[model samples]
Target: MTAIRTLLVANRGEIARRVFRTASAMGIRTVAVHSDPDAHAPHVLDADRAVSLGGSTPAESYLDAAKILDAARRAGADAVHPGYGFLAENAGFAAACAAAGLVFVGPSPESIAAMGRKDRAKEIARKAGVPVLPDAPVTGDDPDGWAVAGADVGFPLLVKATAGGGGKGMRLVTGPDGLAEAITGARREAAGAFGDAAVFLERHLGFARHVEVQVFGDVHGGAVHLGERECSVQRRHQKVLEESPSPAVTPELRERMGATAVALVRELGYVGAGTVEFLLDEDGDFFFLEMNTRLQVEHPVTEEVYGLDLVRMQLRVAAGEPLGLDRAPEPRGHAIEVRLYAEDPANGYLPAPGPLHHYAHPTHPGVRFEDGVAAPGEVSPFYDPMLAKVVAHAPTRAEAAAMLAGALDATEVHGPVTNRAMLAALLRDPDFLAGETRTDFLDRHPVLLAPPPPTPEVVHLGAAVAVTAARRRAADPVTSLAPPGFRLLPGSAPATARWTPIGGEPADVGYRLGAAFGDTALTVTVGGTTTELGLRDLGPDGVRVVHDGVAVPCIVRVHPDGSVWVNDPAAQSGWRPEPRLPDPELSAAAAGPVAEVPGTVAAVLVAAGDQVTAGQKLVVLEAMKMEHPATAAADGVVAAVHVEPGQYVEAHTVLVTLTTGPTA
Candidate 1:
């Protein structure tokens, strides 16, 4: 059998780190390829050696097949492991590796090319006796013609990109009126994400469970299915959470689906790790959705239950080792995995890429935190915003869910806005707890998407307490005496500080030491309310605040921008000291049309002197692989266009100026 002594990982972030862990355990040397922004990335430090790809975007770095092949050759890697995303499913890249005399740890190039096209894969599945969806025949690229074809397929249909997965280039058309626009947008997104603009229409099931079977094939043609993962909890057609041994799937159904997945892979002569996705209707009938010819992001959930390392298995199978499994192993426990992203769920799930000043994971039994970024790292806009995957395992599904929810609640992430709170809320959602999750879970439960913002008073109190704690630590006797304005003097007026919470007015905070709790207690006044809090310093950045006899652990960090960030179990707040100038320039932009998220201007629908009605679509901004249409707030004449198509814009940047029209 051929042996892989050294392996080159042709991916970035968590997936790269994942492969390196497996390679190190097997006594194999690991090499990593990184872009300029990722030079200090966690994965780069974890590798034996690293090559510089020297580009910020994926196109110039990770997706550059030539650069990757060259790096592998330079590192003298015997095999190339594409750890999902980037070039993982790229047939051309796999073929290039084979030409370079390097083993590719994935399916054959021929198999990838066959399954890459959704329309062609459906035909193959049908021929293989697998139940397939009745999709509309792909017409030309014209939107008008596609709209007509979509009518025949009926309303409530899905426009899916043929070349890629991960919710990119996929749109749901609820009616005929939106069919053309949906098709056009889908094509643009698909082309940008996958380099393929071709799309097809499929019937959208109103109520369905998104289930996929994990299958592995060896070069010797031996294949088996390792059960199913229920990925019904989704937002914007992207899976947010995945669990193994779906609560809905019975033993008989699992066998039927597993057998079909294995038979299809064997017929296609596939090898390595792959996932066969299906949609289970309300009546329990299942239909083939598509096949991913590479490792899936949710593979860890399967690994946890099956007690197998899928990545290690990939390496062994690529080295010409047979799976040697006569039958699939039964899963012993339920595992749930949640994708942690640098996104703001309250704001249309817009990506929030920024610094991660204070990042900490929960440590507990049956919990696994697989992350890519360490604290003091920046989440760049050049790649996907997913920071990590938190997985939890337990003997029962309820226990697993409860354990994951608590872990998420206790986890701390500062700097960039994240979906941690929303994820925690979803885990504790009544419908979710009842196992009634579906593809439209988020759509049905809008409240879960945007949890109520922390009250102004709560945020103000948290920030003030955090700042007070920092001052107390800095004034420790061993370091130095308390600074001016902070030193407590007998009969002296209380020390006062002015701070503002995000989106809130400035709050006046006054604090003085209280005799009841000695020097550790502070009588703090926020806004106009006064309260006594018992504080214990837990080192430099941590404090235990006793409020109403309940001890609450809080971590605080001072950001480079002079903002104090407070993270507690119940709330998180970023407080900034009142500015002297009040930033009048920024205030002027707030009166006009501004980008809601940082993104590139894809289309500018209005120009100077154009008259528009209220709610008219003005510009289309693309961010995090999704397009956001910015519209007019009132009927007005466009006075100026501040941004042009193809220009990058930041959040709150004015994109257009308008002069409101006189009311009729």
Candidate 2:
């Protein structure tokens, strides 16, 4: 067996850190390569040695095989682990690593090439006696040709990019009216993400569940399945939640699916860690989807359930070791994993990349957090906006789901909008708890996208905290020495502060401290209701509020942008102190279509004189490997197009101005 001394991870973020953790545990030195923006990333700091690849975008950095190989060479790394994304599935890079005398900790390049393309992979699975969906490759750019091809596949079909996963370069078409645009959008997104515009048409199963089996192989022709993960809960075709031991799968079905996956693995002579994904229908019949040749994002659930470290297994297999087991291990307990992204679920899951003002992880039992960014760190717009992966393992599925929900609710993440609340809500959702989860879960339950409104008690607590903080800051060094409520004038007017919750109207909070020393009683008024609460343990960090004789602990954080976030057991709310006088520029900028996120303009569909209807696409912006279209809000003539293709723009930057009605 060839032993590896130093290993280099040709990727960034949590996966890199994960590899480093495993490699370090095995007494192997680790090397990290990063782009310019990721110079001080957590992954880089976790490595024993690091090399800067230079450039920010993936094309100029992570995707550059030459730079990665050079870095490995400079670092004297004997092995390379591509921790998903970037070039993990790149066959040429894997082949190059082998040619350069470096051990590639994955399947052979031939296997990658064979399974990388979804169309070819389906054919291989079909030939191996595995069930597969009917599909046809995209031929020409002609809309009519695409229409004919799509018709053959039937209505409610998916235009999927053959080269990549993660929902990129994928579009759903419900009817003939949307077939052309879906094909165009899918091809464009595919080319941008995968460097391949090749697409295929496949029938869309409305209620099909996405399930994948974790399969591993060794050089000695040994293969095994480590159970299955149900990743049916999705948004925009991307998985949001994953769990091991699907509630819908019976023991017999699991065996059949696992055996089927193992058969494919043996057929391909696959080695290392890989996942065989399938679409499970209501009738228990399953169809093979694309196989991910690299370690999956949701592998932690499988790892937790199986009590195995897949990364360590990968390292061992790369060393030319044989599988020690003849069959798959029986899973012990249930595990659930949720992907926390810096995105706005209410706003089409748009990537919300920015500085994390306040970030606190929950230290709850049975919870595991794999984070990529730290507090006060910036979520760069150049990469995926996934902030962390939170996994919970327990004796039962219900306990695991509840534990995960509580942990997520307790996690204090502020600043840019996130899907934390939505995730927590989904975990606690009744339907979800009952395991009614399907691929259309999110589309069917739109209310979950928007978090429940903060309770009245929580609102008052936030306002009270805001007022207390303001009072502390306003007091002079000498006046601060006085007792908590020692007012110079008897019966003085109560201090007042106005706070406006995000997307809510401004509410006035009037508060007055108690008259006696050590008296934590504080009278707070929110809207038309006034309540006397005990504000004990007041500090810069947090405060405890005793309302109705029940003590409720709260964590409050103030950002430099004049926004205050208060998180309590019930909920978390952020409020921006309403300006005394609104800026005049706000009204003037309301008549244009604005970019929802910071990104580069990919296309401009309208000219200054172009007339457009409501919902007509005016411009398309791409960021975090996803495209977002800026559309018109009303029928209007475009007065000006403010952006062009290839132009970088900031969030809320106006892309097009419109002149409606008489103004036209």
Candidate 3:
């Protein structure tokens, strides 16, 4: 162990900011490392000293062990803290830091190497008499041994990548027929993702809640376990919501699970922060999953409930200080965290990365937000989709639920579509509130209700407001110089404007600028209807005017290229057929030949002369972990094939051409 006074945070974004806050509290000087794009990031501004890692892509910056180590050395940082993701669990990075005489504020390289492999973790769990899923290893050089091992586990087994998490490179097999194929596919994916193809088998539990205990180990040979977190709500094996004092955990179960987790960490000499995950069955029977050898994404909830600064504890433990385990442990209250992601829940939750147009968080007590980026546009596709983690703590679970719901409702993130509403729904749903949920909660019940279609009246009101704002801009030059309108403007509109009139007749009407009546603030005039509007904001972006006490967002936009767009947000939408089919002349890129869309090539189906029809799946492109099929423009023979099965192509890179027309 080393006495580290200056720490180098070998990561970027919010996690880095989080680590620095704790390090700074300990009177430790911090060194921040950043990539080219993140040079001006908040984390950089928070550090005592800053260094650039060079390059924007993760591989060129964060994962480059040499660059990170050099940064630590140059910045005079005696220790490096690999915060959570990127290279946190990389045993190689840990060893290199140790070999360079720098303290790695995490577990030792040997411990990481042992538990980082999921198979080895299972073995450790089994030897410690921890309850593990009934399964057998299928790895062997002898064919007879392979058959015997396969028979022992039988069908409906899972092939899990030994070096993977996040459900990547894991396959579910329901029968022996698909066992080999599934394993092969799992291995390929695992190799591509973790750079290791080794996999093992396990029993696939159809229904279970994911609960994990946080445990800490000390050099003085003492280990203690914290309470468990209910992580039953997950999407694609990634935890979306987490809460402590799980409804499933009684006093007896909590004690039993906590003891088991502590025993494993002590027996394995696991140090620093780690999570021991277990699949809890309905009958209160729990089995060991695997240990995550680094900080977890959902650690904030635990911190809130335990009243502990986990990051600070990590630093103290790594510094060879006693963990202060002289006293007993206690966990009180309830805490919950919801991951705010830059994704569209309506569009199959596809990643929606772009510049944020506007953002504002709900301000209230008992609410904490750990964010990676802030307003003024900072969403990127090259990183994880999570934008922030909003956490709330309360004396009771009900209060916690209400707190989260109110916070999300008050949150204003107008830049992109998010799962805030969905997460809020989960917190308020009866099933979730009672803590009775499974991993398939979202899949079994899609809470995505298409908002009711925008009322034609609102559209008409929007048209009127657009016309008013446009005329206002032309009428007053001083107000035009102001921002769109005002920051979340508050007022009472003179009248509620309607786009098309009632009785199918168009009309125009306005109220006195300074007139008020009881039961209503501003007067509204329609062709045949008069109403008032509780104005929220009146800006260049249009008016967010509420009528009949209902809020309606009106988008008033004057395009830079001289186009006007005024519309209401659709509550829901169904897939509609395109009225205009793609034309050959309208192919993308237009550089002699159209190019392939941005994605990883799943397959190239056509050759130089194979005939194909329109809408045929010519090539499958996988982006953000979803398969998108690119089809042919029209019926034609493939003139030339350019892409391979595993080749990565960017947007507008020519893939194939049609023989029927000159490669337009």
Instruction: Pick the lDDT winner.
Output: 2
Model 3 lDDT per residue over 1-664, tens place: 5577999999877888899998998889999998887788778999999999998656668878999999998999999999976778889999999899898989988888888888888888999999888676657545466446566877667888888587766777887667775676667656555667788888878788999998888787878787899888877667888999788889899989989998888888888888999999989999998998888888898999988988988998998887887422577789998898877665656666555645567578999988777766656544666778899999999999889877876665645456766776777778787777787777766753222233445443543454455456657866566433332235645443323321123345564232133211334465556665654555555555566667666655432222333445432111111113445554642322333334567567677778777666676555443344567766677877778887767655677777554332
- Give candidate 1 regions above 4 Å deviation: 452-460, 469-540, 568-573, 579-583, 662-664
Query: What tens-digit string does per-residue lDDT give for candidate 2 at 1-664?
Result: 9999999999999899899999999999999999999999999999999999999888889999999999999999999999898889989999999999999999999999999999999999989989888788888878888888888999889999999899999999999999998888888888877788999999999989999998999999999988899999998898999999999998889999999999989888999899999999999999999889999999999889988999999999999998787877788889999999998898888888887787887788889999998877889998999999999999999999999988987887777788888998899889999999999999989999996744455444544453445357447676665655655366778778776765357878777766434645677777778887776766665677776767777777778876778788767777776545643553465666787788889889889988788888989888999999988888888998888998889877878888874334
Q: What is the lDDT of every predicted structure here?
A: 0.83, 0.86, 0.72
**Winner by TM-score between candidate 2 and candidate 1:** 2
- Model 1 global lDDT (CA atoms, 0 to 1): 0.83
Query: Can you write out model 1's per-residue Cα lDDT over 438-472, one digit (the tens) per residue?
Result: 89889899998767643334533643555555565
What are the per-model numbers of colliding residue pairs? 0, 0, 9
Worst 10 residues of 2 by lDDT: 458-467
Clashing pairs in 3: 450-572, 451-571, 451-572, 460-498, 460-499, 461-499, 484-540, 485-539, 524-531
Ranking by TM-score: 2, 1, 3
Q: Considering only N, C-alpha and C atoms within 3 Å, which residue pairs clash in candidate 1?
A: none
CA error at residue 572 for candidate 2, angstroms: 2.9
The local distance difference test score of model 2 is: 0.86
Let me know the TM-score candidate 2 reaches against the reference structure: 0.94
Q: Output the better candidate (1/3) by lDDT.
A: 1
